[model samples]
Target: MIGWREGADRVGDLRGRLLDRVGTGTVDIDRIAGRTLAEGLDAPRAVPDRSHSTMDGYAFAAGDDYPLAVIEADVFPEDDPPELAAGEAVRIATGAPVPDSADAVLKREEAAVEDGRLTGPELDPGTYVYERGSNVAEGERLFEAGERLAPRDALLLGDLGVDEVTVRERLSVGLLATGTEIHEGRSRDLDSPMLANLVSAWGHEPTHEGSVPDDYERVESRIAALAAEHDVVVTTGGTSVGDKDYVVRALDALGEVLFHRVALRPGKPIAVADLPEHDAVAVAVPGKPVGAHAVTTLVARPLFTGESELSTVEATLSTDVGIGPAGFTYAVPVVLEDETATPLGHADSALQVYEETFDPSVLSSSTRATRADGFVLTESGLAAGDAVDVVPYPAVER
Candidate 1:
């Protein structure tokens, strides 16, 4: 098995190769959030276009003495103001375009205007002025290829007069569950629904293709069909070395298995494959619910979102937590409160499943474990008060 970082890197490389297959299209700026840019974008025009006023005051060339002549007309955001002569000022509203000859704005509260004369404290150049191209310069590189757009990015694009953006098309994901108990209706197909929600939240379309038994031929056939229909096929369960674990075998027969497992506890059996024949990718995750969520977000997310970086928050551990193994990196779920993180399944916590050591096997199946606010990835044991970076659920879920 490879390390988790290496697994993420491999999946990111797969995304680059699959970029062309996914293609690109134009989307309205309002709908561009969560989409990856297909090409780098240069600012078509400078933001604000020209120098303006940042406050409702006077505008005039700096380095001039006070008691200047006041312009008769006021400048609002919608109207352009006339040029001002030296020792002259104009009443300007916020966002109003400042005249080319004017640079300083004296606040209305400080200015004394009487008999068309304006007087205020000494002013500096560019004071209270929004300089042209200060926000975004013309021809400046705004976004790079493969950069994912956030909702807040719309504000900048809108200011640049951009109504639409070219972004890579969203990947279509097919969720498949493999287990006799689930296929026969004796057990709930928990992974498919959760996987579907995750794929959608990652800005992709997910279709729950339903479950198939642990039959080798059946698993192979269903995977082949799903691969042909979707850009990605996400299979849950049947990833171990057991006789009933046919997902990995089927993937190997259908395509190239990039890696079979990762050095991650509770999620070690994750697998990624490239289905070249069908022009699709397959990610096989362990059946355990918590493990499935952890592996997919850490490893498979980059394939869909082109993002591998995890946003983390620093917190103090409230309890000592130990790992069972030395080589594996364990994802210990923790509840964050008042800048302190308490391991969810620790004996001191509500679950009370483990004493000092983290039991991933049991915790992976515990639905209560989902209540964790985030998780800490640690290779060694953690002591109380130790500073750790916690990857919040919202960081990966979105």
Candidate 2:
């Protein structure tokens, strides 16, 4: 009786639970990218650490206009400037520390020197001078616990002089694709490679255990081995209640099924389970390519990365898309063009085969997948010109 909405909610809950249970570890700044912090980071001192010049100009005390004597030496960035005495001016370059006695800097273009005397416009206090502690104050919190560090974020931490950070350990995922056809090489194993890419893109390590046949013994044995070796075990195919579906049976024998089915198209037979003996979680995705893609995006993404929601954008539908059942959610592939969502294939179709009606057999058609940018999910049919939420594939950067 689990609907798509409820299933999504459970997946979100599972994300939180897994992070709480998986624990964390310490890593150097170079290796911290894509890792979430286990603890908050507070700056012990301010950035820049001292006052300096922001312009290539001359540093001096500001006051009434004066024909002052310019110092013989020019100040560079690394120089330790001597204190400025009354009516004295020192030539300073950009990023050079301002002398303690100086309160302003005049742009070189604004000032002209003749002989030993420098003449320039009147200056205000603090002009062209970067103040100490302006960028970041001492003891300020930079990042909170559970924040995932991107490459730029990690660089920022390094700029703050942080040598190392404590982060949650990356989960190791095992991918197993099940089906007799796949095992016998009659059908190409597509889901395993796709899932591995997805897992890696989400910042986790994936170990593809390859395909297992529809036999219960093989499925059970593979699940046990994978679960014992990985933090998460993901399987594609054999999740439905059909005669050949052995994933659920194997899961029941080794652990507990948290949820069985979702009220969704293409990916309705998805299943989730937790294996206590192996300290791992198992997820089963439908074998159909589009279904497996949707399920992985909807379930595995949040489960492994701790993301609350899929990144989505609003767009206008270029054509009508027929909804499935009134209560079930539908996933429709579309090519986004200039803010308009063009639904792929013919009208009211969930599965778009090669120039024909949606057939499960054509689910492995790579050409159809390449035609669309991403898929849009909706609970009701969308008419042309209607605004809709489009969930882009992870491949799309934005």
Candidate 3:
């Protein structure tokens, strides 16, 4: 099978697979902030509006107040307040541009204005108002090409008065959850919609969200429908060799199975397939919660993001940790301090995902403080200080 490792084909490698972002469109600037540098259009992006209103306080030239600014109330004569004198304090609102000839802003609260007689403490030396482009430099690189649009970034767009962000189009994703016992979307239950939360976190829109019981025909149809609609398809459960393990079968019917098992811990039995119809790719994650998370973050993440490889780090084990059974990939949660990793106990895949939140697994346990920066695979055993590779959260690497 094509895969990555010593001798296998590098099915999981993404280097050349990343798509060059095409024509850009006007997106709300707020939508593009704080996303990773690797998750954006494959080109440079220019911001729309540079100036924004910051009502906190209006700026003015040094020594240019009509009177003294009272600490609480606003400066009077809203418009054409006065010709800014060298020592005058004009009553300006929080967001109004400061008048020239005044270098300091006396916060209304900082002063006591008596019947328009402005009197306040001597201001600092430099200009007190927020300068234009002070927060964002002119031609500042708010985002390079291939950046993620997150919540914080979205707010920035608002603060900057950015109307639209020229960004790469959204990556199309097909989500298929397979399990006989797991209720389908029709159930409309809380647990059934869990994967949707994780999918949206990374910026991929779910094109086909459905479930298939242990049936090959249903799975096949789901695959066919998704292959036509999306660029990548991700299915949860049914990846193992069990009788209900129909994902491999259904995928093989559509295209070639690149690899069935990976060396990664906690997420073995992961498989990759290429569908020719939609020019899309597919990955099958095992049913176990941990397994499901592993495949999505490690394998599917880069694939959907069009990144050629995953992100990982070098870590030294601080304690002896082993899988319950030998030869199994052992994925452990670790707390990072410098180059050392402190293992979090009870790291089995069975932990509750939502109740507790770890970087890799959802848990209610206090171990949320302890995170799995990444995972390491082992066949024999490891001692404290053993050097290991820790993969970080994955996204499309631009």
Candidate 4:
């Protein structure tokens, strides 16, 4: 088995290969949220375009003597600022472009205007002024290729007069659950709906292609059909080496299995493959619900989102949690409170499946473990009060 980091790296490599075949398109700024930029974007023009007032005050050339002549024309946001002569000031509202000669703006309340003359405190150059190119300079790189665009990015793009952007097309993913229990209605297919939600959250289109029994032929044929219909096929369950576990075997027969398993506890059975014949990729997740979620977010996520880094929050461990194995990296679920993380399956937690040592096997199947705020990935045991980096669900979910 390989390490989880290597698994993520392989998934990232798959992302690059998939991107080359997916293509790109132009999208309006309104519809660009959650999309990846296909090419770098540079500022066409400088922000503010020209020097403008940051306050509703008077614009005057600094270093001029007191009691300067006040210009009659007031500058509004839409009006062209009238030229100011030496020892002259003009009324300027907030966001109004300052005259070319003006270098400072004095607040209205601070200014003394009497007998068509203006007097204010001593001013320095560029005070109370939004300087030209201060926000964004022309030819400055605004966004780089492969950066995912968020809704907040629209504010900057719209201010820069960018109405649309070029972004890579969203991946079309098909979710297939494999299990005799699920196919026979004896067990509910929990992983498919969750995987579909995850795929959608990762900015991809996910279709629940339904489930197939443990039969190798059925699993192989269904996977092939799904691969033909989607850019990616995500199969849940039947990833282990058991006789009934046929997802991995079917993938091996249909394509090239990149990696069979990772050294991740509860989620080690996850597998990734390249289905070149169908021009698609396959990700086989373990049957365990928690393990399925953990591995997909840590490994398969990069294939769709093009991101490998985990955003984490530092917290104090509330209790000592021991790992059964030293070689595998364990993802221990925890509930966060006041910067303290309490392992979810601990004796003190809501789910008491273990005393001190974490029971990943049982915790992976516990539905209550889903209430965890985040998880701590560690290879060794964690002592109480130790500082741990918790990867929050929100950080990976969307």
Candidate 5:
């Protein structure tokens, strides 16, 4: 893991990452709530004529009667439905629209319409009928750009009678994992789940997910094919100067490498390169588990999903952290108290085993972590009382 400064320097424009060939698409309004404006092709709908209810009640000026008030009835949303003259009441139901001639409504339970005359107990003003346009105002901006549309967003659009929307097409980032020693889980042979996982976060899905086995030709072919099929391409492993690192050669073959390495620990091998398409950027990360995880938050997140840059909040250290590496950065995990954070362990590329819990399936009832909150230890050494920042892991929610 890289220090806070090293991680911060690798982030890209938040909005630019969202600009990967988005276009109008059809989606029910319900899903828009959690989705960003870039994913939802949305447009404003013409205001719809809605009614408070269809109830017909005594419409009369409020406060005119305490125990009894002179009332008139008859109101509808339509033009010229009926008029309530002075000192008279109109019988309305639960859903009937209040007549323009009426100002307030006396509920049927509260008033009695007997023998063509209405009488009701006294009530407060503005008790019965709904005010006009109380639900929505005329000419209101429903949704703004860069906002994620949620279920309510879709419902609101439907309520507004909007059918079609103009939106950019969701982005598609190509996923490429470099290195020969890197291996996916047991079931995956050619599938790159790290790349595949980017789909949901990055606004697009992967068309291909195959790892390059440290061979320049095989890696180059996969990257080229994916780059052609998707907006952006990502590669894991083979990013450092190891003999098996093939990402450098593959990227050089495809397009120009913007930057080959970042001055950070754990993820120092990270490289951000340009693709053939506009706004298409590819990030190459190391093969280590922690390296890939850290790189995802730093380079992958912004390049693919346009998510907020890695955020840091203050906490106190739980243990003593001795950082002897000179001029190097480290991402450490800490146990957070009310505002104090406790260092969990030393965070290094090869030190992820500390966070892993025993696989109950493999060894049931093992004394390992069942759950943990991911925390980052700054490059600065820390002690039990030292201050730190706790960034919740992506898998865990605060």
Candidate 6:
């Protein structure tokens, strides 16, 4: 009987609890993408550890005027050139270390070289010179704890001489889709595949336990066994208070039910349970496709990634979206176009799969949920031009 607000608040608690039980592993920086940072990473030393020249040119004391004697040896990236004496300069290439006596670099194009002498326009000190540790200082925090590693972030870490990083081990999730209809092939078990892909996209391993029938004993045995084998167990269907809903009953008998329901339209039947016997947490999402997707993104994703902030974007609604019978909040799918969030199937909508209806009932079907790129959550019906926060699909950008 929890309200949507309370349910959403509890999501943070669930995330903290799950993350506390998760394990950590060391991974090569190249393979660390999508993994959670178990500890904050700091720059061991300043990047570009030494002062260097940024252009292929002549390096000399800024106060040295007129023709300066060019050093016999050229300074390349790997060479350590001798210090410039009075009225002396050295030919330095880009990325080459600057001699301690030099404070400025004159680009080759700007310098006049003749007969072992080089001359250039007088410039201020430090011009065209890259100072030591300019990019990052020593011991600066590079990434905070709990940050999810992105590919680019890993690349940057690699550039900083970090070959490996400690990251949270990816969890092994057991996916189960419940319903006698699916078991009998009367209805296709779409939830299993969808949930599996989502779990994979979130950097976890998904072991599809297959669809379970409505029998009480089988449900109990399947859940208990999967819980024993996996770090987390996720089931779709049999969460609501229906005569055939044996999943919840089995979970209640086998574990501690953290919460049974959330006040959310198309997804109110969500449930979470802690199975201490198997050392795993079990999450039950609604059988309806959109409902399952929403709960997984809002609740399950944070648990896996250890992210506290929900991802969302602000956009203007293109048309009036009804929210009648307003006891529950709604996840209204919409197509974004030209910075505006047009209701699905509108004249200017960007997505082609949207139907004209805004009813939550349509989301109950597995296929209809695919018709949206993302959705807007609102407690009251939205009028045209109202600004709303849209949560996109966790893996898809558009």
The numbered model that scores best in TM-score is 1
Whole-model Cα lDDT of every candidate shown, in order: 0.92, 0.79, 0.55, 0.92, 0.55, 0.79
Instruction: Please write out the lDDT profile of model 5 over residues 162-200, one tens digit for every residue.
Output: 654545566676666555554443323322564465456
Superposed by TM-score, candidate 5 places the C-alpha of residue 76 at a distance from the truth, in angstroms, of 11
Model 6, runs deviating above 4 Å: 1-9, 12-23, 61-70, 86-88, 101-103, 112-126, 308-316, 345-357, 387-389, 394-398
Tens digit of lDDT per residue, candidate 6, span 53-167? 9999999989988699997989999988787898999999999999988989999999998999888799888988998788888899989877778888866686588999987
- Model 4, 193-312: lDDT tens digits are 889889888888999988899898999999999999999999999999998999988899999999999999878999999999998999999989999999999988899888889999
The per-residue C-alpha lDDT of model 1 at residue 387 equals 98
TM-score of candidate 1 against the unseen true structure: 0.96
Off by over 4 Å in 2: 1-9, 16-27, 60-73, 85-89, 100-104, 112-127, 313-315, 347-367, 387-389, 395-398
Sorted by TM-score (best first), the order is 1, 4, 6, 2, 5, 3
Off by over 4 Å in 5: 1-23, 30-135, 145-148, 163-170, 182-191, 201-203, 243-246, 249-253, 256-266, 277-280, 309-331, 334-371, 376-390, 394-398
Window of ten residues with lowest summed lDDT in model 1? 80-89
Off by over 4 Å in 1: none
Give the TM-scores of the predictions, in the order they appear: 0.96, 0.82, 0.55, 0.95, 0.65, 0.85
Candidate 2's error at 38, in angstroms?
Answer: 4.0
RMSD (CA, Å), candidate 1 to true, equals 1.5
Tens-digit lDDT track for model 3 on 1-398?
A: 22224212344353124334223455556565333344333112233222222334433454444464432334432432344544445556655545445555666566665775666565564434555455665455566556556666656666555566666555566777787666443433222244455556656566557677878899888887887777677787777788878898888999877778776555667788877655667777766565556545555555444344545678897766544444444455555669886555434333324221222223212233224555554565667779977655443212
Which candidate would rank higher by TM-score, 2 or 3?
Answer: 2
The per-prediction tally of clashing pairs is 0, 1, 42, 0, 47, 0
